[model samples]
Structures are given as C-alpha cells and as structure tokens.
Target: QAGPGTIGRIVRVLLAEWNRFGQQVMMDGRVIQRGWRETQRGFDDRVGLFWRYGTGINLDGDDTDHPWSAAFISYTMRTAGVPDHLFPRSRRHSTYIHFAQQNALVNDPDTAFIAHRLEAYAPKVGDLVAYTRSGAANYDRYVNRARYKSHTDIVTYVHHGEIGVIGGNVADSVTLKRLKRGGAGRLIDDSHAWFAVIENRLPLR
Candidate 1:
C-alpha cells in the first residue's frame, strides 16, 4: 500500500491539474463552464497528454470518438506515482473499480484501494467515488470484471455536509464537483447512481 505521503501527492497532483484547467467548479447541480475545454484551442494537447499517460494512445482531445474521463483519472494516479499493481492505468473506470472491489473482497493489505458501498464508508481525500451511468449498472455486475459504463472522481476535500471531487472530461474539461453529504456523513447525489467509494488505505502522514 502507498503511504500517506503518496495520498498527499495524489491530491496535490489533482489540484494542480484542476488549476491548470482553469479551476472549474460544479455546484448546486449546475456545471460551471469557466475553464478550458478539451476541444478548445491550446487545450487539446493537454488532453492528449492524459490519453498518453492513461492509455498509451496518441489521440488528441479533439477526437471525441473516445471518452477520456477515465484516462484523466489514470493519468492523475500514475503521475502521482501510484504503483501499477495498486492502481492500474486504464481507459475505463470499471477496470480499477473492479480491481478495488476484488481487493475489498480479499481484504488485501497491499492494495491501496478498497471498494465499499456508499453507506459503508465516508470518502476522504485521494479516495475515489464511482457511479454507474447505464440502467444496467450495478455493484454485482463489476464483480465479474464485466465491461460497463461508469465514471469516477477523486475526492479532493470533505467538509460539513459537503465533499469536493475532481474528475476529467467533465463538462468537456477537468472539473470539480461539489456533492452533498447525507445522513451519517455518507455521500448522496441524486444526479447519479453511486455504487461505491474506493477508500484510500494508504497510511496518512
């Protein structure tokens, strides 16, 4: 498992990228479109870098045929020096989500991430919050390593009844989303069918 410093590094990397993308924020269930988008001039190259680091693909941001949201998460984790064994870079969020689920099932001490039901854990900085987009998506579906459409965001901060998460390809750029915390400090967002929060098990500094 990665140490607390690694988790700190991951959060720093994500915040730095967010700033680079103009510090866009999504609040009150509305998107804030103030920053650079993936297709905009002078910004496509950055998206290309995400693709390169996440998928080893040379595709540019203007190529909308491929969604780069997962790539963005991969890039962030990899750039933060997360080990491939703990957090494998992938083009799909389901890959790491599934991996985390397996780690939870086995209670693997070496795994940096462990998946838990939304009610089971309150997310912390560097943890991942994942949700399903399709009607067929469910927690059991990922146990078999099945391909599914999903999205994940890294938790940047947690406050009273609120949490800040950052994700790539949101509103066509890297964006920060503010979500409400429900009873018992659990995360609740009616906008998406959230299934899991991959807890960061790395020791805190």
Candidate 2:
C-alpha cells in the first residue's frame, strides 16, 4: 500500500495534467482562447494505451465517431501511478465506475473510493464526477460505464458555487468545466447529465 500522503500526490498529479491540457473558462467550463482545435488532437497522444500499448491513430479530437474520454481518464490515473488493483486501466468509463461501485457497496474502508449520488456529495479536488449525458434518471440502475454513454471529469479546483473539473472529449478536446453548486456548496442541477461523484477517500489519508 502507498504511504499516508499518497492521495495528495495523486491529486497534485491530476491537477498538473489538467494544467498541461490547457487553460479553461471557469465561468462556463470550456477553453476559450487556447485554440479549441488543440482539444481535438490530445487523444492521439494516448492512442497507444487504447491499442494495447501500441501506437495511437492520428485521428482528430472532433471525430465524434470515436470517443476517447474514457481513455483520457485512464491515462490520467495510470500516469499518476495509481495502484492497478485500486483502479482499473480501462477504455470504458463503465469499467472503472463499476470498480468504484463494487467497492462502495462492500463498504470497503481499506480502499480509497466511495460512490455517492450527485446531490449527496460535495466533490473535492481529485474526486471524479461521472455523468449520464443523456439526462437519464435511472443512472443508479446501470452498474457499468458501458451500460450507458457516460462521461467523467476530475475535480481540479473548487471556488464559490463551482467545482472546477477537467476531462477529455468535451468540446472535442480535454476541457475544464466549472460546475455550478448551491448555496450550501452542493451541486445544483446544471442540466448536463451529471449523476454521481466518486469521492476519492484515499485523498483523505
């Protein structure tokens, strides 16, 4: 197992990568000045992982024909040196989401994750927010990321009434979003298909 300061290390690594991905428009969540075209090609850089450690395609980010959001999240976790057992290296959001769900259900205190409903939790930095972009209310029933089309973002910063998160495949690149929250610092309905936040309990170590 990692030492006491492991979670903080992970958070720092995640935020650094978010910064490398580029700047963001915190008020809304998309990158405005840094050539939105840049978001389109970030995935080509990680195509190797998706290809079983082989080379990635030269495909552009705007190619909605293939979504690399899951790959981007996996790349971040793997790059941060997260233990393979605690997190799955997957190209599907449902895969990791399932891993988190399984652990949460068992109340596995030894692990570093706890999945909660969107309204039940106030996400902090390094935590993951998964969405059912279709606005489906039955999201809780879907046990896997592949069960439906889902997206995820890593919380990088939190400010007044907003949680700043960065994830891949938004607006055709790795984009950051400032998700709105209520007066109590709880996330409000932002009409963006968000369903749950996978709190990184490990960060609290």
Candidate 3:
C-alpha cells in the first residue's frame, strides 16, 4: 500500500500540472479560456510529452485525429508516482476506467482505485470523475468489449455545494472545471452524461 501521503502527492502534482497549462477555468456554464493549447505554437511540445510519457505514443499533440485527453490523465498518474500495477496507463480512458470497474467488482486489493456508480460514491480530492462523450454510452455500458468515447477529470477540490475538477484537452487546453452538486452532495448531470466516480483508495493524509 502507498504511504499515507500518496494522495497529497497526487493532488499537488495535479495542481502543478494545471498551473503549467496557464490555469484555465470553467465554471457556472461560463468558460474562462486562457492557456496553452495542444495545437498552439510553442505548446505542442508539452502535449507531445504527454503522449510519449503517458501513452508511449510518439504522435504530435497537434494531430487532430488523436485526442490527448486520456494521455493527459495517464501522464498525471505516472507523474504522480503511481505504480503501473496499481494504475493502468493507456491512450484511451476506457481502458483504465474498465480496469477500475473490474477492481470494484472483484474487490481487488492491489488496485489503487475502484469504480462506483455516481450515486453510490461522493468523489473526493484525488478521485476521478468520468463521463461518456458519445453514442449510447452510460454507467451500465460494458467498457471491455470495445473502446468507448469518454473523458475523466481528477477531483481537486470538494467544498460546499461545489467540486472542482481538472482535465486536459478540454477546450483544447488543460482546464479546471467547477461543477455544482445536488442536495445530496453528488454531482448533477449536465451536458456530460456522467457515469462513475473512481474512488481513490490509496492512503490519504
């Protein structure tokens, strides 16, 4: 098991990465766009790094055909010192999402995360919030059969009536999004059809 400070380290790494992308913010249906984007000149190197280090792919960030959001999440986990055995790094978010779901289904002790239905779990800092991005995908959709278009954001802050999450490739940049919560302190569905919240089970300080 990771030491008690692992979760803290993860949060710190996430915030630092967010700062590197110029601290873009999205809140209350309004987007504050101000940051380096993957396609922007002079910033492609960073995105490229995400692909190489996160997914072992040499594709350039400006390659519009290949989205780097999942790579960004993988990069964050790798940079945070998560062991490969505990966190699966992949170019597609569905890979790791499915792994977490399997962990929960089997009660795997070696995994660092467990997938929970949105209503069954209230995400905290260091957890991941996931949503489907296309075609009939939802919480019950089986992810192992094939790739599903989806996205996930790391939970960075949880406070009264709101929670803040940071994701990459949002608006073409690493963006911090603030979302409102329902009376139960759970996320409210919006344009994104949220399905699961991958709980961070690592020891937290």
Model number with the top lDDT: 1
How do the candidates rank by TM-score, highest first? Answer: 1, 3, 2
**lDDT score for candidate 2 against the true structure:** 0.65
TM-score for each prediction? Answer: 0.94, 0.79, 0.92
lDDT per residue (tens digit) for residues 128-168 in model 3: 99887765646777545337788899989999888999998
Give the per-residue lDDT digits (tens) of candidate 1, residues 20-78: 99998987657855788899887899999999987798887899889999999999888
lDDT of 2 at 6: 59
Total clashing residue pairs per candidate?
0, 4, 0
Deviating ranges (above 4 Å) for candidate 3: 1-3, 28-30, 143-146
Instruction: Itemize residue pairs with steric clashes in candidate 2.
Output: 29-177, 39-173, 40-61, 94-145
Candidate 2 off by > 4 Å: 26-43, 46-64, 144-146
Error of 3 at 3 (Å): 4.1
* TM-score of decoy 3: 0.92
Model 2, span 88-140: residue lDDT tens:
76667777777787777798788776677777778887889887755574546
lDDT, residue 103, candidate 3? 85
Q: How far is candidate 2 from the true structure (C-alpha RMSD, Å)?
A: 3.6
